[model samples]
Target: MSEAAFETEPVPDRERFEDASHVLHGPAGSAAWRQVLYALYVVALLSGLYGFTVTRAVVERYGQSWRAAGAVLPVAAGGAVLVVVLLVLAHLAGRRRGPVTPDPAWVDLVVASSVDRWLTLRESWLLPGLTLLVAGGLLGGVGGAALVGGGATGPVALPVGLGGGLLVGGALALSWLSGQVRADPSGPSRRGIGASLGSALRMRTALRGLGVDGLRAHSLRAARIGGATFTADTRSLRLEVAAPVSRGRRWRLHPGGRVRTLLRRDLLGLRRQPLLPVGGALLVLPGALAAGWVVAGDAPALVAVLGVFGLQLGAGLVAEGLRQHGDALGAPRLLGGSVRGQALAHSGAPALLLLLLGAPVAAVSAGALAGPVAAGAAVIAVLGIGAVVLAGLWLAAFRGQPPMGAFGPNGGPTTLLLWWAWPRVLSVAVGALVLVRLARLGAGEAGIGSVVLVALLLGVLLPVADSALTRAAAAHRG
Candidate 1:
C-alpha cells in the first residue's frame, strides 16, 4: 500500500472504542466503588509521580549508588500504592450507579471465558518480564563472562547453570500443571493460572454489567443509564451507543464520523522514532556470521543460519516496537485495546529490516550476487509473514487479553518471559526447522539450503503470519 493511503486509513476514536468487542469491568465494582476507587487511583497516581520524581532527582545527584537503590524504593512503594489503588478502582468501578461491564469469557476461568481476564496478567506481569528477561540474561552472561575474565569462578558458573535450570524446571512444572488441571473434569473448571485470571476477569466484566444497572456488589448507591447520557453525579464511564443499543449489549460502529476519524488520526499517526531492529541486525551480524561459519561449511547452510539470526534479532526488535506502539495507541482508550495496531506497526518495520539485513548477507554468501539477493529477498518474505502473525500477540498484551507468558507465570525465574512473543519464537523455530531439513537434502550445500529456506518462508512463516494477524485483529476488542 502507498504510504499516503496507508497513513490515511480512516478510523476514529469513539468509533474505535465503540467497535471494541468485549468490554470488561473489574471485580469489587459498584457506584460507591468508583468514588473510593478514583480516590485510591489518585493516591496511587500521586505516589507513582512522587516516587518517579524523587528517583530522578536522586539519580541526577548521586552516581549509581545508594541513591539508585533509593530511587527504586519509591517506585516500589508507589507500585504497592497503585496496587491498592487498582484494587479499589475495581471495587469502585463496580459500584458505579449503573450496571457495570461484563467479561465474555465467564465460561470457565481456565482458557479465559473472555479476553479481559486473559490480558490482565499480561499487562500486570507478562510484558515487563518479556521485556526484561533477555536483557537480564544478556547481562547475566556479560557479568558471568566479565567475572570469569577478572578471576571469579566458583560462584559464577554455578549460579548461571543452577539458576537457568531452575527457571527451565519451573516453567515445565507450571505448564504440566496447567495440562493436568485442565484435564481434570471437576478440578476447578478453570485450570492453572488462567483459571484464577479468568475469575478475576469475570469479576471485572460482571462489574461493568452490574454497574450500568445502578447496583454494586456491596455499595449502597445505584446508577442508571438513559440514552447515551448517564445520570448527573453518576460519574460512570461514558459509553456511547447507537440506536437499537440496549442494556447488557456491546457498543458498535457508531460513534460519529468526526470521533472515528480523530481516533484513527491520533493512534495511526505516522510520527515515529528510529526503529530499533535495523540497528539490532547490524549489531548481531558479526556474531551470527561467525556462528554460521562454525555451524556449517556449506554456503547455503551458512546463509540460512544467518537468516535465522536475522529473524531472532528482527523478532526482538519487532516485539519492542509493538510494545511502544501499545504505549502510544493505548493512551486514548486506556483500555489497551489498540495493542494489535501497535503490533502491526512495530512488526512492519522489522519485517522490512529483515529484508535489508538478509539480502546483502545472503548475496555475499551465495558466491554470486544474484543468489544472495534472492536468498535475502526470500528471507524477508518469510519473516515478513512471521511478523504479521506476531501482531496477533500485541492484542494479547492488552489488559484483558491472555497471558502467554514465555516461560509461564508463577513468579518463578521462568515468569520472566513473554509467552506472547510468538514472532520471535516462530522465526527461530522456522529457521531451525528449515536449516536442519535442508542441510540433509544436500545439493552438496547451497542449492538445497536455498530451496529449504525459501520453502519455510513460503510455506510456514507467511501462512502463519496471515492467520495470526487475522485472529488478533478480530479478538483485540475483547
Candidate 2:
C-alpha cells in the first residue's frame, strides 16, 4: 500500500482509543457502588457529629474546670497533628516505592494511543479526593466541638471548623500535587501552577522553596528507610550512607542466647514498623488525660474505672499493632517449635512498654486530678490492665490471628476474622471480666474473696480454652 493510502486507513489502536475515551470520563465503579459509598460517607458524617456532641458533653460534665479543658485541648490538637504526620510519612514511604506507572497493556493502549494522562488519572483521583473531604470534614467537626468545649462557644466553632478543614484539605491537596509532579515531571500538567508546587516538593529544591528538608528527613526517619534520599521522582531515589557509628559493646540482657535472639529480632521488627509503636503511644496519651478528667469528677472510683476502660481499649489497640507486625512477618514460621516462647518475646516489647510507661502516667494523672488514694489504685489497676493487654496479645499471637485483624488483607471484611477467632474473642471477654472484677473490688462492690476466685478461675479457664483453640486451629490448618 502507498503511504498516503495507509494513512487514510484506520489504525486499530487509534480506533480502540477513541472508543475507550467515552468510558474514561466517569467513575470506574458502577452507579450502585458509588451510591453505597456516598451513603457510607453520609453515615460517617452523621456519626462524627454525634461523637462530637458526646465528647463535648463529657468535657462539660467532667472537665468543667478551665484547667482541665486547657490540658485536654492541647492533647487533642497534638494527636490530630500526629495523625497527619504519620499519614504524610506513610505517603512519602509509598512514594519512595514508585508512583502508579501504567502497565505494558495500559501503555500500549493509552499512552501510545495519545490519551491525556490527566484523563487516565482522573478516575483514580475521585476516591482519594472523597477520602480527603470526608476526613477533613470529620476532623474539622471534632476540632470545632473541642474548641466549643474549651470555652470558644457561639460562632467561634464555625471559624475553627472552616479553618481546620481548609488546613487539612490544603495539606492533602499539596501532597497530591507533589506526588503528581514526582510521577511525571514533563507532563503538560506541570507547565502551569503545578510546576511551582512540584519543584517545591522536590527534595533537592524543597529546602529552597518550602523548607521541607527537615520534614523530609523526619519522614525518612519515621518510615525506617534512613540512609535513602528521595528525588523529585521518588522512583529514582538513591541510597546515601552516612558515617557509621561505632558498634559499642553491649551486654546480653536476656538469660538464654536463644531468648536474646528472638527478642532482638522482634525488637528490630517493631523498629521497622515505627507507625504502630509511635501512633499507639500517642493514642494512649488521651487515656491518661481521660483518667485525670474522670478522677476529678463526682463518682471518682466509678469514673476512674471507666478511665481504666479507656486504658484497656488503648492497650488493646497497641496489642493489635504488635499482632499485625507479627502476622506480617509470620512469627509462627520464624519461631517454629518455640512458637509459644517466641510469641511471648515478640509480644513482650509492647506489653513491657505499656506497663513501664502506662502505669506511671496513669498514676500521675490520677494523683494530679484526684488524690493519692486514686493514684495508688490507678497504679494497681493499670498494672492489671497491662497484664490483660499482654494476655490478649498472647492469645492473638499463638492463635495465629490478630486480636482485631489488623494485618488482614486490606479492605477485607473483618467480620470473618471475628467469627472465626472465637477463642480470641473469649480471651478478651475473660480479660475484661477480670478488669471489671478488679475495679469492683476497688469500688467496694465486690469482696477480695470474689476477686481471688475470678482470678483463679481465669487462670484455670484460659488454659482449657487455649487447648481447645489449639486443637481447632491444628485441625483447620490440616
Candidate 3:
C-alpha cells in the first residue's frame, strides 16, 4: 500500500492490539501455570499451618475477653475504622501506582496506540480485582471461624464473613481505581464518595477519556519509582513520591534567634505541606490512645508494639526537618550552627506538635482504661515515648545510604532491609519494651522507687543515644 493510503487506513481494534500484545509479550505457557500452582500450594500450606496452630489459641484468648466485655459494638466500630483507613490507603496507593498501570514499554507501544483502553488494559484491572476478592473472602472466612470458635457468633457467621469481606474488598478496589482516575489532571472534577463509586463503575469509560499524554507521563513516573524500589534506593523513592510545594508561598519567616529561626522554618515547611502535620496528628492520636491503653494494662503487649509503630510513623511525618538536615549533613553548615544544636532545633517543632496532639488523647484513654488517677502517668509515658521515638527517627533519618557490604554476597536483600530498618526496629522494640514493663509494673503494684529508677535510666540513655546518632549521621555525611 502507498504511504498516504496506509496512513489514512482505519486503525485496528482493541482485540487486534490485545492479540498483538499477547504475541509480543509471549503467551503464558506451562511454566506460568506451574508457578501459579506452586503459589497456591504455598498459600494453602501456610493457611493450614496458621489455622491449626495460631488461630485457635488467639481466638480463645481474645474471643473470651471480647465476649465478656460485650464487644459487639467495639468490634463493629473497630471494623468501621479499619475499613475507612484501608479505603483511604487504597486511594492514596492508587494515586501513586494505579491498578491499571502496565509496564512503561507496554504503554509506549500498545496503550498509546489507537485502541480501546478498556479492552487493552482490562487485564491489569481484572488481576487486582480478582486477587482482592479472593483475599478478602479468605480473611473474612478466617474471622468468621474465629468468632464461631470464640462463641461470639453462630455458624452462620462464616458465610456472612465471607460475603462481607468480599464486599469490602470490592469497595477497596473501587476506591483504588477512583483515586487513579481522580489523579488524572484532565479527568473529571467531581469528588466525594458518590463520585468515587460512580467513577469506579465507569472506569472503563474514564480510562478511555483520559489523555494518552497524561497516561504516558504517569507511566514514566511510575517506572522510575519502580526502578528505585527494585534497587532499594529509598532516597530516590522518597524524592519520586514527594509532591512539589505549591501552598503557603506567601508566608515568610521573620528574623529571629538561630534555634527559633530553625523551628519557624520547620513550621513554615509544614504549613506549605499541611497534609504532613495533619496526617501525623491523625496517626499520633490513635497511637497515643493505644499507648495509653497499653500503659493502663488494658491491652496486650502486641498492642504496645503496634502503638509504637504508629507513633514512629507519625513522628517521622512531622520530622521532615530532621530528615532535610540529615540529607544536607555533608554540605557546608548553611545555618552556621553546630550539628547537634541544629538537630535539636529541628526536633523542637515535632516535639511540641506531638505533645499537643497526642497527650490529651493518651490521657483520656488512660483515664477511661484505668481511671483518672492513671491519666497523669499516661501523659508522662507518652512524652517519654515520644522523645525516644523522635530520637530514633533522627537516627533513622541520618542513617545514610546502606554500606556496600550490606549488599555483598554474604549479605543479601534481607540484610539490606534490616540495615535500612534497624533504627526504626530498635526504637519500636525499646518503646514497646518500656510500655510493656511499665504495664507489668503497674499491674504488680510496683513501688514508686522502681518506677522512678526506670524513668531516670531512660532519661540518661535517651540524650546519649540521640547525641551518638547525630554524630554518626554527621560522620556519614562527612
Q: Which candidate is the best by TM-score?
A: 3
Per-model tally of clashing residue pairs: 56, 0, 0
Q: lDDT per residue, candidate 1, 76-136, as tens digits?
A: 4644553444333333332232121222232223122233433322222232222233333
Off by over 4 Å in 1: 1-278, 287-310, 318-346, 365-400, 403-423, 435-467
Q: Write the per-residue lDDT of candidate 3 for residues 1-478, one digit (tens) a residue.
A: 8999998988669567758667776675224335554665676577656863466567767766656655447648767887887888788767766677766666777777777877667766776776677677767877777777766679998899889988988988888887777776677665565665587888677667655666766677788897786566876787777777878889999859889999999999999988788878877877887887876775756678888888888888888888788777777777687888888899987788768877788878888878776677777777777767876877777666677766677866677788878888888887776666565443456577757766875786577667765676658666
Evaluated against the true structure, the overall lDDT of model 2 is: 0.51
Evaluated at residue 204, the lDDT of candidate 2 is 36
- Candidate closer to the true structure by TM-score (higher is better), 1 or 2: 2
Ten residues in sequence with the least summed lDDT for candidate 2:
227-236
Each model's lDDT: 0.38, 0.51, 0.74
Instruction: Estimate the lDDT of model 3.
Output: 0.74
Q: Could you arrange the candidates by lDDT from highest to lowest?
A: 3, 2, 1
C-alpha displacement of 268 in model 2, angstroms? Answer: 3.1
